[model samples]
Target: MKIATKKIAACAILALATGLFYQESARAAIPIQQWKASNGAQVYLVESHAIPMVDVQIDFDAGGRRDPADKAGLASVTAAQASSGVAARGAEPGLDENALGEAWADLGASFGGSAGSDRMSFGLRSLSEPGLLAKAAQLAARQLGEPAFPEAMWLRDRERMAASIRQANTRPSTLAGRAYAAAVYGSHPYGFEVTEATLARISVNDMKALHRSLVEPCRAKISIVGDVTRAQAQTLVNTLLSRLRLTVPARCAPLPPVAEVAPLAAADLRNIPFESAQAHVLMGQPGYKRTDPDFFALTVGNYILGGGGFVSRLSSEVREKRGLSYSVYSYFSPGLHAGAFTVGLQTRPDQARQAVEVVRQVIQTFVAGGPTDAELQAAKDNLIGGFALRIDSNRKLLDNVANIAWNKLPLDYLDSWTQQVEKVTVADIKAAFRAKLQPEKMVTVILGATP
Candidate 1:
């Protein structure tokens, strides 16, 4: 049986790797279907019969932002431990972590859970053959609703995580990140760090309680991509969420609102001394939320500013013209709330100040005048040309669908993405950047830099 399972798994993997399952061209228009599930879950599907496999992502409102400040990392550890084991249900026997792994392997499918800053997600991938998909969905539902949160397993994983945190603390990058987050986010939950003490505070009961309260069917947004019809996808979603034990009220209760990431009040600078030869510098401020109207403008503008790699103005100014650093980049991490807009680079400790000054000047100039006509044209052309790569595979399409579902974006968002990028004019970029970024109030963190 084991040998047979190994062969099946290998064949499934090979099929996926060789793109044998996908038949559609990358540039085809994606027709998205959206509906409300019987259990109040929002379901989004893109029926692609070209592939005989399915990719799914289920997202909930439970994530790091939901964690209590006193017990940071609760959502993360809860998500991790959900797959540790599943409790027995009547006639079915309980499965430990190892048993769970074996079961998924035998079916040539995979399911796992993770939590990011704004949402907790469970993802599953499997061949859509009737028997295989049924077994995979059932197993996933069981794991989702019946996690044991074994005390022994939690204790073991906690120790391992604590040790990893200790090792990370010794690195300059970690230290810089921690300081930068604290400086930028202030009292926001987004800045909460997972310390050894915080890990020690997380008990199995906490995981169970959090999972019980937040992982409700009503709060789920299910995104599916692959070779399944609407009826089949509906059934698959129902089965995948069947194990959730909580009864849904006629109307789901509103969760307590998390405070937004606050805008910086003043420029804050931290110069930490370390023994490293290269200095790490990070500077930024709260940008904007995913739902902001200026998203496309900000995105296109960021590309010209620093997100376009060596072609970006920041790179041209900081790396090529002055030769202060080999690389320098900036990005906007917009989420449910205003995420950070950061510029980062590494340079010789002695040259750190010069690099920092150059990056600052470049940003100030760009924010004031916006990109030139030529730069704006180039950014739009590059972004539009490369859009196909975003949805080239099942996994990537699933991610994009999930983003749409979570952010409440339009159903035609993916299809109209290039149009949005193309329509972003120099005036739009300038107005958006001027409204969102405040260079004078940005937070700066420099580690291993000389005074």
Candidate 2:
């Protein structure tokens, strides 16, 4: 959404938060209306007439982190099955995932989303036509509250997923990822990835057990964006929510302790020997959580360091200048807990060790010195300049809203995004990086010949 005009006092204040200096008749709105449903589900609604479509996303704290140590993929499986309607045993006759999808298609709508480290997210996108919202809402309510976990679909999905994991085990990149997660997270739930063995042990009943504990109203966040008015959105939410059997706990269950919380104070390295066409290198240590104040700094700084692609320091040093590899990049993954700041690349086996060393050197120097003023300004410019595109589409806005609600970020977060990036000074980036990153105690994973 373009910055709106400041003539209206409220719009003006919101515009100012965007750090936009131009004089406009109106400013974009972030009037997020929030309320808790009878079942204790948190709902956030943003009305936008920019499109005639409505987007709905509901997230539960039912991601991998909620998966038991022995049943690492249950949360994901449950969410997936719920969305597809395949595991929703009590659904209407002939309403498998495919049939549900066909019904939605008839109504000019789509249904999908993903499970992640901290959330099992699902979405519904449809024209704001007369009956679409009610129908979509009904389906979502049943799937969320009363899934049956159909055995046939579960067996099929489990077998398919197990085979995929088995195949991924043969890929160097996949092995490196598994190794990296294990090395960095230690015993943290984030470290757990489903293995063939783990998948085999997860029965259909196990999924239902995990599903019962994690998919509760006490742990749900709902975000709606599009052409609907706030009143209309509320009606839709309230009706759909009435079906849930919420039992709010006295206190949210605490996450298990992370075996390692400190960013590496010394290098933790692992090398897996495998015959590959090219060496895969991965490096980084613990990074920030989604709510970390320094998140903006880390995000902007990472652009100049490696997140900015060819213009970034890592690319400039490792690929453009030295011609070591065609590509290299880095990112700070903000999750339910502290995430990893991973840097990755691939190069010829002969140059694998040197490439890893060069990457480390680049990180060491950048962490020590930070980005140049020019680099910092450019990153901010690019990031701020491209901010509008982040929510240009209905789906995109829905995604951002879901993230904000799921993370409990301020509703004005998107409105102030540009200003936050603009206010990030070189000092902020440097200081934040130095404090958050530890090059000395990083984990490095390389899949190739180790000499």
Candidate 3:
């Protein structure tokens, strides 16, 4: 996901200039109301009377990471079907899966689902009118519990995914991303993509079996935010969750522990057989999880390194100094286990190697001598001051809360994040990098380049 830096920089500068800004001081602690439904489903509720809408997200432990070895796309295929209309013929009848999605989108009631490495998420957003809420909640429940992955629908989606994989072969950006994931994760499930072979291999029975095994109430977390009271939230949770039978599956196996391997001395080059003028270069190594202690430090440090555009070392070096690319960035994608820490940029095919070298050098310089006190302070100030903006809206709060729930983070994490960032001294920054990011161990992939 790309960071919209134009708004970020404008806000960050204002935050930096203001020596002391205390938005949260007067605001009471973000009250997180929690309860268990009769069906053993845990519900997390945050009542925000600020907006006249409600957003509900239900997450199950059944994500794509658990897709069986033989049926690599089963989990994702199942997830997509879940948001499509149910097989039941009720007030909404004869609406096929794809039609249901389009219909919901047309009606202004947003519904969708994604299968990530660790969990499957199904959510709905709509106005909080009691009628709308009830309809939305009922629709969500039906989709969650009774999706029929019709042969026609399955074939269409599978064909689409397969086409994407084929197209990816010719896309340099896609090539670099795929290589980077494979290099960092090796043969781990996280490295696997939705291939035509995988899609063709997935049967309807595979999706049904996976759904039966994984989408259980006990292994789920529910988040309700916006114009909903405790009672309204409880009703919604119970209505949707009570139908779900709570049967916890056996715990997933732990990630095969991965250690950084030596970096490539010669760049790994792939010919996607495309004629794009720009080359996509992605470089980095294994990343940390969400709850890692060094998260706050790495977050702020990365901002200066590349996460903060225009103000970042990468932007200065790659764009301002040499005009190698329009934009460049480095980011840590935190997942259930370790995600990727990737630095990516698109430059003319001729200049891709130079751009990669610049990124590597910048990282090396930081590893040897961490960010200056001034840079560290700027990051800290920006993070702390901008905390309010992050949580200003109910949707934003729901996202943060969902992340906390999915990652099993402390309830008061947002409250404590600022303090942790403030405590990250330069020594701490250096130490964190030394432990987590290895400059020499990063695997570099330059796509759309000559061998």
Candidate 4:
């Protein structure tokens, strides 16, 4: 199974600038109205009169992790097909991609979807003009409730996807990422990227079957945000959510725990020699789940380590002090299961070993002794000061709300985020880093020119 991610290097660059300029003030605390629909789907709503718009998202536990062992990229295909068109059914007809786009555009609304590690998401955004919200909601409801997965488009999409995968083989950074995942997690679903063979096995029938189990109401959590009132929000949710399959699937089992492959006892460095001027290097190992107790500490510590780019320890050593590489960075990507804490850099082939040595030293030093008082203070101030931009827009707020509800995080998660970062002391940073990062057990993969 492949959990395909669309990577964004920087979460938000001009967030602070935009907030300060546009005055995206912190509105009232997000009063998320929580309840269940008559069909058993979880529902959350936050009413805001800040803007004349609305954002709605429906989430399902139908991500790459749930794909069959034989069909690796099935989850991604299923979600992708939903946005391109509405397939034809027995009595109901279908809408082509152009028709769908025109329909939304005519209403000044937009609809889209994505599949990830633990969930697939479909959302709608529209102006809160008279009748526009309901019309847009109905359009989203129809797409989710009745995806056709039409035959003509299937062949096109499959070929396009397969070609994309084949193209990734020639890129060293892509190769290193795929190899590193496989090495660290072993046979876990998180261990693999989508392969061409797996793509070949996926058919239109496979997607429809996956959709049956996925599009059921019981598997859904709906989030609504905007100028709508409680009555409007409830009605809107009911209209949108009631379109899902009413009965639960008979074999819906709870998800299993993240596979625990014991960290390596010695260095696990792999070199894939190819003709190249520079080497792509990646190192680190299994990290933490999204709801881990030490989340705050790890988050702040990572900023000081490599996540802050120019200001980070890795940048200071690898770029400032020695000029061994163009850039160096690290991050902890927490998902539904144990995600990786990865550090990556690109450097000349001859200096690859030196780059690796310096990164390891930084990790060992940070683990043996935590960040300084100045480093900790700076991290906290940056995180705390930048907190407003996270919730500055309705779209951003909608995303955070969806995360809290779907991940079973505290409703107060966003509200308490700054305070949590504020409480992460130096000891907390050291303990969390030592526990989570397996520096000695780190799996290092390098792609460079062969002698």
Give the alpha-carbon lDDT of every model.
0.90, 0.77, 0.74, 0.80
What is the C-alpha lDDT profile of model 3 across 184-203, one tens digit per residue?
A: 77766777776788788898
What are the clashing pairs of model 3? none
TM-score ranking of the models: 1, 4, 2, 3
lDDT of 1 by residue, 1-451 (tens): 5476456656755665665344353565789999998888999999877656788999999999999898999999999999899999899999999999989888878999999999999999887888788989999999998998899999999999999999999999999999999999999988999999999998999999999999989889999998799999999999988988545552468999999998898999999999998999999999999999999999999999999999999999999998999999999999998999999999999999999888889999999999999999999899988886777677878889999999999999998899999899999999999999999899999999987
**Any idea what lDDT model 2 has?**
0.77
Candidate 3 lands at a TM-score of: 0.84
Q: Identify the superior model by lDDT, candidate 1 or candidate 4.
A: 1
Best by TM-score: 1
Worst 10 residues of 1 by lDDT: 17-26
Best candidate, lDDT-wise? 1
- As for model 2, its CA RMSD to the true structure in angstroms is 7.1
Would you list the clashing residue pairs of candidate 4?
none
Q: How close is candidate 2 to the true structure, as a TM-score?
A: 0.88
**Residue lDDT tens for model 2, 250-320:** 23465454343445557878888998889999999889888899989999999999999999999999999
The alpha-carbon root-mean-square deviation between model 1 and the true structure, to one decimal in Å, is 1.5
lDDT of candidate 1 at residue 326, scale 0 to 100: 90
TM-score of each: 0.97, 0.88, 0.84, 0.91
lDDT of predicted model 3? 0.74
- What's the distance in Å from true for residue 21, model 1? 7.0
